[model samples]
Target: MEAVDVIEVSREAIWVALKVGGPALVIALVIGLVISLFQALTQMQEMTLSFVPKILALFLALMGLAPFMLTVLSEFTVTLMDRIVALG
Candidate 1:
């Protein structure tokens, strides 16, 4: 493939990756921030306190978002396959 084609594919891959993973990441971030604030206010500095909630939140977010993520990934895969066929 040409350089431009390669760059475009790489950019698209990264975008797809971010889009697929963004929701869980965002959920985790929010949970972590909230837990941090609570810890700060209550002065409860248990290191493991933050992990379980974040993990659960992230799991729920991922489960909720799985269909959307699958659609995005499938679309990206189709587009990529089309591009490959066009290249060939």
Candidate 2:
């Protein structure tokens, strides 16, 4: 592929990555911030406390968004395959 084609593919890959990751990332960020605030107020500086909630929140977020993520990934895969087929 030419440079432009490579750039376009890379950009699409990044976009797909962002879409797949954005929800979990946002959820983790929010959970971490809230936990941080709670810890600050209560003076309970247990590092593990922050981790479990963040992980759980991220897991739940991922589960909830799985279908949409799958759809995006599948679409990307199909498009990539079609491009390969066309080139071949």
Candidate 3:
């Protein structure tokens, strides 16, 4: 409830967000870079060429990593709930 508590909570929330999302973000970044390179090499600038693969890869990655992501988010939620109870 104090400024320090708020800052701590905010920092934790950001960390949890990153933990949950970082994998997908990394996958997307790598996929995008690879696709860009391929496009550059092949001289194929089709819009779908870049977007479709990234979307599919991201979806597959999210599916594959769902359990880990769920565990992290659940742990963070439990931590937040504990803090809320303590505050109350």
Best by TM-score: 3
Candidate 3 regions exceeding 4 Å error are none
lDDT score for candidate 2 against the true structure: 0.93
TM-score of 1: 0.94
Over 1-88, each residue of candidate 3 has an lDDT whose tens digit, in order, gives 9999999989999998999899999999999999999999999999999999999999999999999999999998999899999987
TM-score of each: 0.94, 0.94, 0.95
- What RMSD, rounded to one decimal, does every model reach? 0.9, 0.8, 0.8
Candidate 2, TM-score vs. the true structure? 0.94
lDDT: the better of candidates 1 and 3 = 3
Badly placed stretches (over 4 Å) of model 2 are none
| RMSD (CA, angstroms), candidate 1 | 0.9
Highest lDDT against the true fold, candidate: 3
TM-score of 3: 0.95
Clashing pairs in 3: none
